[model samples]
Target: MHKRMAMLAFIILVVAWGIPSAKAACSTPVVNASFGSVTSFAVNSTASTSSGSLSVNCGSSLATIFNTDTISVRLTASTFASGTQAIMKKVGDSSGDNIPITVCLSVQNCGSPMTIGAPATTFNSTQLSIFLLTGGKNFTIPLFFSTQPGQTVAAGTYTTTLSFLTNWDICTGLGVGIGGIQICVIDQNGSATLSLTVTLEVTNDCTTILAPAVNFGTAPLLSSFSSVVQTISVTCTKGSVYTVGLNDGIHAVNGVRNMASGSNLIRYDIYQSTTNNRWGSSIASQRWSSTNATSVSTNQLIRNYNYTATLLSGQTTPVEGNYSDTITVDLSF
Candidate 1:
């Protein structure tokens, strides 16, 4: 009877120990790992304005150690494992309490509190994906901004840094242990800027006054007249040249338009040559010159032979006729 009792006690003790061992075997192993390398991460400015997502793969090394669907890692906003999670954050510099940007993180392949397991052992074969949580989709969550009104940011390289921590709960027969993974979140910002240029051109206004036609009625015989000055006034571009017309019958006497007249009715000055009225000789003349309006060293009329005169008394005669002359002026740079 005593031997049987001792045997029974022994069996009970073995079963108690076995129960705990069985529970330990079923629990998942703990794993804390990094991205394996401090590789570069990229963010596109032109990409969706909302926060983006990425995958931090647990290559073969981390896969084999914790090899179970229950084994997993999670990201937190806090710098340390125990700190509060980093929910949505601004990715850039901010004038207020936080930086000027907003950043959010998520599991690309699974939701938060997710589990990871591998079907293969190769480094490339193992994978995990993280994405923005609620507002991560193209137009779901909005990207906050406090941009200066009426002003656009210049194009350049803008970099933002984010600190992250990943942790896992590893189960052992005795208790649970915590492990941590360190990660860096970097955002590369890009943009395009534009500049505008305007050009204007100006021109000059051309103006001129031509010689006036003169008429003389019948006058005293042997009439004569003093010379008339032809003037040209430049109203626009300075130092420009103008051309004037002249002929043998009408000549320019030192920039003057002079015409000789006869005083008698039969000896009257005729604008045009006539053989019968030769008792007195008749003559006509015109002149021309040019100058810049602004720096007119000598003031001159733009009109060719702007003014003229005729005699109509004794020693002067009136010439009857619609006397007229043509003048041409051209401007050239």
Candidate 2:
């Protein structure tokens, strides 16, 4: 009978041990887009014309060399969209200093890889022909080159480039815009334009921190005690040390008191001194430092310190009155 009972208990324990446990849920997010490999569409012309009731009044010298005049490309990625898409357009010859040029772009339904080119007289290719210089918004885009005040484009080549990433799926498309350029001299015109046939991916999500200011209250001290305790409290970042000291605020508490001294007596007996009197002339008088107090920190309600007061031997027992002193507290990071 005993052996049968033991076997039954063992069977119950085995069944309990075989029971399955519940699983915990995970919190990872699903990200499914790449925006790092996109490039800006190409700018065909050196000067772009705005559609928004704007005009360009190039002098006779610039007008004559409109085709061969030195032009540069520039780009700015300020336009942000919802979801995960961002556009950054770069123009060729972006470093041409002091000279202004116009730029334009067009978007089309690309089949696979994307391609952009100069304005065509007629629609011959499968891609749509977007006229950047013909018309549209009156916004003016400016491009320039760095040069000595009066020196012109010193008979050389110049260019600029721009690129952007799609916030959603990696789609080959052109960012629309009417580019402009700036100029200080007009000698020989040599320009550079960018090609928008390549694709790139991009990323733009990040994190940051925030901090608040510290506020303080008026501090008070005991007026009669030379060795008084000043309390201070502050809030700060975790695992960081905050140091506070006196001398930063006004001192209000001051004064001193006399202490009596005595010794032990017979068995189970306690002898004390209760004698009271004015400042005496033997030994020393109760004295204290007039300036520069001390500071300390701990996990307690109050901190105490011993200060030497001008002690007068003839002075009798300390007067039976409340004595206090005041000090300042300074807080720092």
Off by over 4 Å in 1: 1-196, 203-211, 214-218, 238-323, 329-333
Model 1, C-alpha of 241: deviation from truth (Å): 5.0
In candidate 2, how many Å is residue 333 off?
A: 5.4
Model 1 TM-score relative to the real fold: 0.23
lDDT of 2 at 94: 39
lDDT of each: 0.26, 0.22
The residue-by-residue lDDT of candidate 1 on 56-142, one tens digit each, is 222111111221121222222232111232221222423211112222223222222311121211111122212112321111111
Top-TM-score structure, candidate number: 1
Clashes of each: 43, 75
Give RMSD (Å) of candidate 1 vs. truth: 26.3
State the number of backbone clashes in model 1: 43
What count of clashes does model 2 give?
A: 75
Every model's TM-score: 0.23, 0.18
